[model samples]
Target: KATMGVIERNGTYEQLGSITTPTLIVVGDEDAATPYSKSERMHFAIKSSKFAVIKRAGHTATVEEPEQVNTVISKFLECCV
Candidate 1:
């Protein structure tokens, strides 16, 4: 219910612009629950952020393409450190 409220109220959207920390916005090319456009919006909102789209994957990109997801996250972390 709380998660639904956050989504319905656009709470996270409202707060995205204020984020200053480095962020990695990842989405699957075929994501439906949280579409690619949403991830793009988040990438734009967060000043310091990177966007990655996993090809041939869906909403469960982490589980569907674990290796690709891990590689992207690893690369992002490397840049951060």
Candidate 2:
């Protein structure tokens, strides 16, 4: 509840548009804590951000689908570099 409230009132949303750095936003298709829609919203907020949704994974996508997560991270890093 507290976390949700903080997320709702956080200034990050307002500052997202100002961020010019490359960002990789990854989330699981089945994530309950932070769903795909929320990730999409973040992607839209950050102009230079990339969004990746791992299939058949949950909130702990990195742990549940390490290969997919690593691949996505690697690709993002490659592009950033």
For each candidate, give its TM-score against the true structure. 0.86, 0.84
Q: Please provide, for model 1 over 1-81, each residue's C-alpha lDDT reduced to its tens digit, 9 standing for 90 to 100.
A: 987886677356888888888899999999998898888998998998999999989999999999999999999999997
Please, what are the lDDT tens digits per residue for candidate 2 over residues 1-81? 987897788466677888899999999999998888888988999997898989989999989999999999999999998
Evaluate all candidate structures by whole-model CA lDDT and list the values in order: 0.91, 0.90
- The TM-score of predicted model 2 comes to 0.84
Best by lDDT: 1
Q: Which ten-residue region of model 1 has the weakest summed lDDT?
A: 3-12
Highest TM-score model number: 1
lDDT of 1 at 48: 81
Worst 10 residues of 2 by lDDT: 6-15
